[model samples]
Target: MDTRERLIESTRELLWERGYVGVSPKAIQQRADAGQGSMYHHFASKEALAAEAIGRSAEQLRAAAETQLSGPGTAVERIGAYLRREREVLRGCPIGRLTQDPEVMAIPALRAPVEQTLAWIRSRLARVLAEGREQGEFSSRLDPDATAAMIIATLQGGYVLARAAGTTEPFDQAVTGTLALIDANVAE
Candidate 1:
């Protein structure tokens, strides 16, 4: 990879492994195998580099989700596919993990991508739920906006639960329960 790409990739990995406070320019340089001069040449500051990295991660997350969400299937099926998609459950959601970092949350530049990505996910799910209701796949009593929020919460919370327990079972159970709830609301 080029110096800029390597730097961005390294920053992404480092940010995932270590929060904003934990990542240093030196660490990024070493991980990217780039010189100090190269990093400074590419990014004006560490925050600048981190913002780019976080933005890249957010883009990837949205694209991955879109594939399943927009794929050929009923709304519940598509949502279930998204929930069951292969994930590093133990490692946690890349963007979701950033919410726990005080530094990341405190910095608007660093936080914008994370917040936007989450909001996008919720909005996308809400749209799909609305579509499902229109098609009679979901009951008219279902509230797409609220259900969408619950799904996102379960997903993000599932990651926390699994990471805290040092196992993937909690995440799996959370997803399964969510699927069951969606199924329960299936139109009669």
Candidate 2:
């Protein structure tokens, strides 16, 4: 990869692995195999580079989710597919983990992409839930907005629980419980 791409990608990995406070410019330079002059030449500051990295990660997350949600399936089926989609459970969600970073959230520029990505996920899932309800795939009483929030919360919380326990089991369990709830509301 070129210098700029490598720097951005390196920053992305470092931010995912280390968060804002833990990742340093030296670390980014070393990881990207770029000199200090190269990094400064491409980006004005660490915050700027970190923002690009986080934005890239957010876009990837949105794209992956859109594939599952937009493909052929009932609303519940699509949502189930999304929930059951393979993930690095132990590593946790990159965007979700940033929510725990005080420094990232404290700065609006650093936090916008994370906030926007999560909002998009919840909104997209809500749309699918609404679609399922309209098609009689799910119960009429199921609130799409609330259910969407719950699903996102469960996935993020599952990551935290699993990371804390040093296993993917909690994450898997969370997915199972969420699927059960969605399944329970399936139209007979």
Candidate 3:
């Protein structure tokens, strides 16, 4: 791969494996197999490179979610598909994990993509829930905005539970329970 591409990819992995504070230009260059001059040539600073990489990761996350949300199925089924979609559970949500990092949370440039990506997810999921409500697939009592926010929280929280326990059972249980709650609310 080209130096620029290599640098970005390396940073992405490093960011996932280690938080923003843990990453350094020298470490990135070593991981990318690029020299200092090459690294500097493509990016002005480590934060700039990280911003590009985080943005790319956020876009990928959105695209992956879009696939499930847009797929042919009822709203619950689409959401269930998203929740059940295979993931590296133990590794945790890339963007969500970043939120726990002080550096990422403190910097606007670092945080914007994470914030926008999550907001996009919540908005899109809300749209689906609203559609379901309109079609009478969901109970009239269900609030789309609240339900969407709960789903986001549950999914991300599941990752934290699973990672903390060093087992996937917590994540699986969360998904199943969330789905059961959704299914229980189905309109007669």
Candidate 4:
């Protein structure tokens, strides 16, 4: 990879592994195998680089979600595919983890991508649910917007629960339960 790409990728990994406060420019330089001059030449500051890295992470997250969400299937089936997709559950959601970082949340530039990405996911899910309702796959009682938010909550909370217990069981259970709930709501 080019020096710029290396720096961004290194920052992305560090940010995911070590929250905002824990990551340092020196650490990023070493991980990227680039020097201080190269980093400064690419990014004006640590926060600037972090913002770029976070934005890239958010873009990847959105694209991944879109893959399962927009794939051919019933709404619930598509959502189930999304929830069940393989993930590094122990590592937690990259963007979601950033919400816990005081520095990231305190900085609007760093937080914007995280916020926008989540909102987009929620909105996309809601659209899928709404389409399912229109297609008679879901009952009229199903609230697309509310259920979309719930799905996101369950996923994010599952990560926290799994990390707290140092296992992926909690996350697995959360996803299973969520899929069951969605299935239960299918039109009779």
Q: Show where candidate 4 strays beyond 4 Å.
A: none
Clashing pairs in 1: none
List the candidate numbers ranked by lDDT, top first: 1, 4, 2, 3
lDDT tens digits by residue: candidate 2, 29-118: 999999999999999999999999999999999999999999897787788889889898888998999999999999999899999999
Instruction: Return the TM-score for each candidate structure.
Output: 0.99, 0.98, 0.98, 0.99
Of the pair 3 and 4, which is ahead by TM-score?
A: 4
In model 3, what is the error at residue 186, expressed in angstroms? 0.9
Measured over all alpha carbons after superposition, the RMSD of each candidate to the real structure, in angstroms, is 0.5, 0.7, 0.7, 0.6
**Residue range 1-188, candidate 1, lDDT tens digits:** 89999999999999988988999999999999999999999999999999999999999999999999999999998999999999999988999999999999999999999999999999999999999999999999999999999999999999999999999999999999999999999999
Superposed model 2: Cα runs more than 4 Å off = none
Q: Which candidate leads in lDDT?
A: 1
Q: Per-residue lDDT for 1-188 in model 3, tens only? A: 89999999999989998989999999999999999999999999999999999998899999999999999999999999888999988999989999999999999999999999999999999999999999999999988898889999999999999999999999999999989988888899
Residue-level error in angstroms, candidate 3, position 64: 0.3
Enumerate residue pairs that collide in model 4.
none
Winner on lDDT (1 vs 2): 1
lDDT of 2 at 77: 76
* Residue 21 displacement (Å), model 2: 0.5
